[model samples]
Structures are given as structure tokens and as C-alpha cells.
Target: MGADPTAIVVGLGLPSDVGTGWLDDLTDGFRDECDLVGAGVAGGDTTRCDLVVISVTALGDLGGRAPVTRSGARPGDVVAVAGRLGHAAAGLALLESGHEGLPGPDGRRRDDPRRDDPRRDGRAEPYGSDERREDGVAGLVGAHRRPRPPYPCGPQAAALGATAMLDVSDGLLQDLGHVARASGVGIALDPGAFTVTPEMERVARLLAADPLDWVLTGGEDHALAATFPAEVRLPPAWTVVGRVTGGEGVQVSGRTVGQGGWDHFRM
Candidate 1:
């Protein structure tokens, strides 16, 4: 299909385990939900074509709204995120352990309230302890293979009086530093203010890693990091992790958080 200059862009890829029918299903799903710009596959004549490549580009109109860049965050604006975080990182651990299911140390399955229906309960139970571990592995695998951006959060921030915004591609602390540097401000994140979920804390305990560090330093959560006016009412999905201050760097409880994001050359 031809591209639409006035529509937003959406991208999709075929999973490694995905068959042709699954790819078709994904494409059809995208068409039903979004105005896709273009879709196709790419390859080269090599002895080993180990990966299937798919790329998509989306063009969107802002309807005359001013674009909110990282430079606009100011002191007193609340810093927040509007989607899931750290699950993929937790999942990666499970996959690396070669677990087939999600089970806690005691053998009780971690209940996911999102699956409240009784009929769906059967399917949800298997996703417990070991199953959860497996899902976590699958999640991290998916995250490494493909990243799903919270596109709406960007536009939503703009619509909801967000002063500044950026996607959380890197670790939260690192990305917030970007916002801070760009806006010529400092951020003070409150670890006490953070409410770690059970699954996340459990994963952290199981991995023997600090849950706070995972939330602070582990990246690829893809949640939206935005700065809103102090008085603005944020949605429930949003978490108040830190605050913007009048300065030039970022800090966690007054201590400077180092810039430790992904760097190919350094690695």
C-alpha cells in the first residue's frame, strides 16, 4: 500500500518462531488498528540468512500542535512514566536460566490480576512461577529482537500539558539525564517514592540484583518519561519517580547518578 503523509507511522516484524500465517496476522492487526505507511521484507543472497528483516516508517501530522522536545523540561515539573518497566529485564533472566515455566521459590504461582476471568484463569495459571520465568525469558528475547515504543505517550504528553518528554530507550537514570542536560536542569529521584511491584521485587531477589538498580539503570522499558507541571493531574499508569531541579546534571537523593547507558564503542 502507498504511504499516507497525514497518518502516524507503525512498524512490525516477524518473530523468529513466526510462520507466514502469523506474519499475515500481525500485518492485518496493524492495518485494523493503525494507518500503516509501508510494509515489506529485506534480504541478501548470502550462505546464511539467519535472520528475517522487516522495517517500517510512519509519518504523522501533529494537527498544528507544538512538538515537545527534551529541551523544554523545567524545574518544578513532575517526571513520570506511563507504561510497564523492567519486566523484560526480569524475563531475560528466566530465559537465560532455561526455565520452562514461571514458579516462585515456594512453588506458588504468581497471580496476574490482569487475567481475572475464570475461563482465562486456566491459561493464566500456567504462566505462574516457572511459567512466569519462561514468559520473562520470552519477554527479554522479544525486547532484544524488537522494541515497541510508546508512541501515544509522546503525543499524549503533548496533549496533557507535558513540558518535556522522551522515550525510555536507555536506563531510566540515563534517559532522565538526557532530559536534564537538554533542559539545563537537574533531577532528584526518590527511591522511597518508588513502589516496587511484587513480580519485580521477586525477580530482583531471585537474580540477587538490586530492584532499585534495575528500575534506575536497566534500560529498554520503552515507557514514556515525561515532565508535567507540578499541579497537573497525572494518570494512574504514570509513576512519580523524580523531580526536575534548576541545575545542569541529574542526581538520586542528592548524589550524582553516573551516565551508564549503552555505548557500542565502550562495550
Candidate 2:
């Protein structure tokens, strides 16, 4: 729903060996982010555990407006997204690939002999500072470290008469499936509509992965996706990606796509 967050309550489970300094740093991070949104840490509980565990409950205010819900989407509504899409996933891929350890223009930390040789088994490996800057891999890494969801856009969508709204914490397709199911309407996405950054494209090339896969199926970007009336003039932050139809399920360019995304239980 499109609501403004007001407060957060944290539940922390930490091992007994953890130091006070570590705890302070953890709490400080939460406070810093909450302060950015004018929210505060209301209260929380802590306990000893085998591993660190965290649970957060966020409270929000809808102002005087009715909450925008997934069930409100109807046929003919325009589906749009605000904020990023695949940056986090691409960043994670870079980290997982051990690219962060490569030296030189890559900005990776480690010094490897391979850095001078550049070739493993006669295959050309892509590396260099100019390419890194142009692709903006560093920025992608930062995006993963701290996802910047368009918080204010939530209320903006609500004010603009968004029929259905949700933050795309999971993959876009999976989260949109929730709206499709709840509203009993179908959503058809345009493959050409999504914006894939150069950094994402570069990462995909290095990994031999489709950038669209990251955009459509990768999770944790936390971009806001909403459905608005066709007549609504969305702000510059929102990009129209799809449309609602009089059916059930989500599709892209006339083909049905799987609702594959982050599932905490499955994980």
C-alpha cells in the first residue's frame, strides 16, 4: 500500500559473544536510515541467539487518503515503476563473481597476477578503468549495499489515483503477480519499456546473463510499481511499463512469465 512510514520496531537476536561496538554500529545504521525519512526507532527487543537474526516492523500513516491496494487494480490501468530495477542484482552478481577481488581499473581490492596477464586460457577478459567508470559498476555496488526506494513516490502515486501499488522488493514479475491475483486482473508488460542501465548490461555481458533477467526476476531493488488510470499524467520519476487487462495473471509481450522471486521460506 502507498503509506508513509512513521516508525520502526526492531527485533534483534544476537550471539552472546558479540561486542557492544558491533551492536552500536548496527543500531546506528538503522537510526541513520530512519532519520532520512523522518521516522524513528520506537522500541525493540533483543535476545541471545546462535546467529544474528533481525525482524523489523514498520508503522506508517496514510494521511487522510484511502490506502492504495493491490485489489484496486482494474482493466485498462497503466502499470508503472518508480526508482531502480536491476542495479542491486547486477551488483550482487559482480560481488559473487569475485570481480571485487580483481585489481587495476576494476577498483577491486586484491592484487592478482592475472591482472597483468588479462587472459585465462586465451580468452579475452574485459577489464579497465574507463569501462568501469562508463559502466558504473561501483555505483551498482553501492546500490546493493543500500537500496534507495522512492519512499515519497508512494504517497505521490496514491495522490495520483493509483489503483494498485507496491514496492518491488521481490522480482518485478513476482510482486506484480500479487497485484494481478489480488485484483483479478491481468498485467501485460512491455519488454522495451524497462530501463536497463549500462552497468547492468556490462555485468550481464561478463556473466553471459540476460540483463532483462535481472530486471524481471532479480529482487531487492525495492522500486515502487503501481497501476494508474490511463488518463493520469505520471511524474518524471515513474515510467510506464505495462497495462492491466480484464483477466488473471501477468504476461510480457503476450507470453506468460513465471513468478520467480525471493521466497524467504524457500530460502
lDDT of 1 at 61: 60
Least accurate 10 contiguous residues by lDDT in model 2: 118-127
What count of clashes does model 1 give?
13
Question: Cα deviation in Å at residue 67, candidate 1?
Answer: 0.8
- Where is model 2 more than 4 Å wrong at Cα? 101-135, 259-267
Q: Least lDDT summed over 10 consecutive residues: which range in candidate 1?
A: 120-129
Q: At residue 158, give the lDDT of candidate 2.
A: 92
Q: What is the lDDT of candidate 1?
A: 0.60
lDDT of each: 0.60, 0.78
Q: Give the alpha carbon lDDT tens digit for every residue of 1-267 in model 2.
A: 777889999999999999998787677767766766788999999999999999999999988789998899999999999988988888778778877543324566543323322122233222222233323666566566656677789888999999999888888988999999999999999989999887677777888878887788777778999999999999998999999998788888777765443232121
Tens digits of lDDT, candidate 1, 1-267? 011234334434434565877565545544433422232222212122346554455455667777778888889998887665665555556456554245655675544422222222222122112224334333443443333444455666677888888777677778888889889998887777765567667666766766666566556667678899999887776788888998767777777766543231121
Best by TM-score: 2
